[model samples]
Target: MLDQAFLLYGANGYTGELIARYAAAYGLQPILAGRNKQALEQLGAELKLPVRVFALDDKIAMQQALQEVPVVVNAAGPYDFTAKQLVEACIAEGRHYLDLNGDAIIYDMIHTYDKAAKDSGVMLLPGAGYDVVPTDCLALWLKQQMPDARSLKIAFAVLNSSLSRGTAINTVLKLGLPGLSRIDGKLVEEPVGKRGMYVQFPGMKKKLFTMSLPWGDLSTAYVSTGIPNIETYINMNKAAWFFLKGQGAYNWLLKTKLVRGIANAIVKRQSPGPDKATRDKTNTLIWAQVSNENGNTLTANMVVPEAYTLTALAALLITRKVLNKEFTPGYQTPATAYGTELIMEIPGVQRGLVQ
Candidate 1:
């Protein structure tokens, strides 16, 4: 049997560090692992946790690194390259997998391996972070309130001073990719900036323009609520959309390995993430509306602290639940395994339906 320990993979990254800090405070002695030995050593020194160093491609080494930890809280991003491998390794090692990844591709991959995870008696819980945790819970809650709903719309507003290097790089990679929506229970791909609209919030005088994107909930919500029509949007201004809309045009260039390498190189020199004070001042809001075929509708809004901060808190809480044996095997969403009120457990999160 695997030991009852959490493994903080990619513990050297900015988000990983945030999770490690909270995991430590929560009295979790997580084994910090990543490719950067020096960085891992530094973080381990501060957190006083053991460190594991191995590249993502080293399958044997990766499996060995995970042997002692029954739960893996992956905080790495641009997870297109990492999530699959980590999931495979976890299943093999009989370790429950969790991550803050918001990528739609990872969700698609999870769908395929869910059965494998079940057979291994391990759980694969992705998007435990800000990407789909709160949004998924809200979607499930709305479904309970209006079980007849056939359509759903979710919008996000993230207020932060700057993006972490991992986040910025993920943005660069995701820019040119086409968007997606769930229509009539089918995953449908749309143009890069399709369905752009200015959405209003509960107490905001100013409306924010949001472009359709393949958020994690696009996959998780259907499993959680059985909603047939789903659409997700990220808050963006005209200036930001201008650049976002242009991605498809130059996607041919941006998609090339050479260009992506350069982009990653440029990101490497920049700061990892916001400072502690900036993070303390940051916040996020999520608004969701669900409507039935008969025109009955329900709307709810949620507010939480900074995206990164929320991820840290959510990760720890979820991890604690897993450790205490409040767990479910196979691919799971936080809302599905926990409940519609899971988001409410967070410190600053508040949710209320619009009357």
Candidate 2:
């Protein structure tokens, strides 16, 4: 039998706490865990779930913590720094793994472990979150609408939910990095801001510029769906765009110890994020367009839940699949394993297509 699943790491972080609360609502009672026992205890108390403390740096502790948990939902961020060790432990323990990893670099690294995971009979799914789940599912849905589809273009826009400190820190770390995608079966690095365009979203038609950051969902979606030509774009407001454009300075600051200290202090002071009222009012809009060799087209709209809530929902869904033996033992995207029909069944998710 599959053992109890745990919300392994980052149970004390802002997004982690939100995911814990969502897990509680579903009566899953995930074992809250992190390096900080006090913070994990506080979060567990707030959610009324059991707490288990373990440090990712400590291999012995992590293995001990995995004793009864056959699955782990990793909410940790800057996954490029944290994913490998836990994944190694999961492989050793024969445990399934899921993570809300939005970093394309990290996803690319994990994809290499596909053969290992398959050989070990343990599934490893990254980007099981708002970053890719909704958009990935939409891609599959669009292809189904037009069976002859040969290419897909996905554009996503979120008007709400302030970026978390972990996200900001990760972005800063990745500054000046060239963004890459698999276009027409070839890897291509495209200039930043040169690929901006307007997407006619459902209920609102607006122009959204392309995000310079790379998303992991594209890699997994392509591998899973076999779509030769695919591109994923993210659109944010002018202020956010300009702020990201100025990240070159942040990257430079990270090089100096003193400057890095100051930056970390500033982030720590401002990392709490928005209040409940602000979060409850937040929403997301996604638009996808698929084109086929037969000159046919299909478009769809996806209404996503609050970003934090959606992370928990996606993770829980993946864990449930692992427990039910409904997943293949390998690295894959959520849509690849669950399919568009199952993802659309989640409440509050809206789907539409235009021909």
Candidate 3:
């Protein structure tokens, strides 16, 4: 049996630190666990919590560290490299697993372990972050409002400052990669930046162009709402899109061994963006428009904080639910596991249907 409160893996990373602070504010005495002993110690001292050191590569150490913890929040990102090991450890220990994974590949990989997790009765929920939570939860809410909806479209727009090193590295690696999403009950390859449309968002009534992307929430929502056709769009400025278009040279660089060197240089030289002023000025908009056979449409809006913080909060909230056995074992999304009613209960969130 696991103890009531256990650990937060990767508690030393940039986003991990934010999660630690948020967890502390929530009155959770989570054991800070990560590879860097010094960084973990520094964070623990700051948060006034005990520190535990365990590298993800050391399976024995990870298992031993998690033995007494009933739940573990994997705040680590670029989860492609870390999710599997942590999930395996949690399964072996019957501990609940939660991650703020936005990588679709990682989500698909975790979904493969659904049967194993179910058999062991360990809850596993990935993408408990801003990427999927707000959008997926909104989709669930929209479906409930329009039970006859057969097809749906989600457009997500975030106005914020510069990108983080981890985000940049991940994006560079995934550039030009094909995306997959279920369309009309078939798995289809989504063309990067191929689809675009203008849609109105709350507060800002102007229509903005949105492009199709592979968001894990769509897959989770398909199962949750049984909606036949689903599509997700990300709204960004034309300048960003043009910048993304100019990344051919960067992609070539990533294909070589110099990627790590280049990434390190960029991180050292670049300043962290979306500063306090930028974050306060920024806002996230999620629009889910559902249409039925009769052509009736319903739209809803959601406000999200800076991407990383929202993801951390959503993951933390899901971790709490897993601890209380409020969710089921096996692969699921926050909206699917917690339900829209519970998801909307989180503070700083609002829900409404567009007339």
Candidate 4:
């Protein structure tokens, strides 16, 4: 045995459960953990794995749990609430920490702990999933083609996929947030959808409209490639784009606690995530372009499995590598630690230069 055991907090969440169910296939053992005792017990029995039930606030219990594994995969979202606690504990305990978060702010916060993580010989990797892995890799790949690139743009689109309840609630919670981008090597905030474009992703028949937002790449890609200006966009239909532009009018309402509470209540009543059948049919598309002052540019495109599916695979893949002692001892994005080929390791991923 390779002693491939690790701790998986929030193991009852949609993405976490998916990772737990597939841990065996990856030749790893995950000790399921979370606050929901009932859910954790059922899942642990089904998966035949050890179980640890403790809320993130239960510091003593959490620290005791950390002693069972050398790595922790956090599948909990709205990472703004969960990341700080778990990351701090991981650094203190010298355990590698990984999360499937794509929030730019969260990435920046984690980066601030780089020195502590390095000093502790702990690897802190955020966005170890769909949020940034493919795009981060693509960004680095495009940068490789244009080593002197001054600007970078990356976009992603999901086809035939639906959001998990956790993802939906997180979206509602951030409804009125401003967009973010990196300019002149600094993070800048601006109106959401401040920039829009049409992208013809690989294998797609037609172009899709995309709007720039504060994606995790706005933070992580800059670390991976010192591109001075980086922008990230997500595909949206014209109607959605129009509504997003008009959101400023109701931004205040969306930010109110009452509206957010109602939104979350509704989200909780829905399905947790796409069923296995839907995940099997969905595809994720990503595009990256890099340009220099002289107008030289290179574009790359990639197609991968559904977002949630890819999240599960990528999170576990990175976990497996960490257990095998194949990781750096500091803060890292997927591409920064494992290189551009990290995305290619997923079974259904394909990448190529744009023609």
Worst lDDT run of 10 residues, candidate 2, spans 186-195
Model 1, 21-68: lDDT tens per residue? Answer: 887566677889989999999988977788999988988888888887
lDDT value for candidate 1? Answer: 0.86
Give one digit per residue, the lDDT tens place, for model 4 in 1-355: 2279999999999999999998889999999999999999999998889999999999999999998889999998889899999999999999999999989989999999999999999999999999899988888888888899999999989878789999998999898878888999999989899899999998889999999988899999999999989999889887888888888899899899999999999999999999999999889989989999999889888999999999999999999999999999999999989998999999989999987
Task: Estimate the lDDT of model 3.
Answer: 0.75
Model 4 misplaced stretches (Cα beyond 4 Å): none
Q: Model 2 over residues 1-355: C-alpha lDDT tens digits?
A: 2244565578787777777777645546578888888888887777677887877888888888777677877887778778998888888888888888886667778888888898889888888888778877878777776767778777777675677787767665654566676678655676444355667666675556655445765576676667777777778565666665555556455466676566667777775655677767866778778888887777777787777667767777667667767888888887777888756756678888754
lDDT of all the models against the reference?
0.86, 0.73, 0.75, 0.92
Runs with alpha carbons beyond 4 Å of true place in candidate 1: 1-4, 242-248
- Model 2 CA deviation exceeding 4 Å by range: 1-4, 205-212, 237-264, 293-296
Assess the local accuracy of residue 158 in candidate 4 as a C-alpha lDDT between 0 and 100: 83
Q: Specify the highest-lDDT model's number.
A: 4
Number of backbone collisions per candidate: 0, 0, 0, 0
Across 27-68, the per-residue lDDT of candidate 3 in tens digits comes to 556788988899999888977888888778888888888886
Give RMSD to native, each candidate: 1.9, 2.9, 2.7, 1.2
- In the predicted model 2, the residue pairs found to clash are none
- By TM-score rank, best first, the candidates go 4, 1, 3, 2
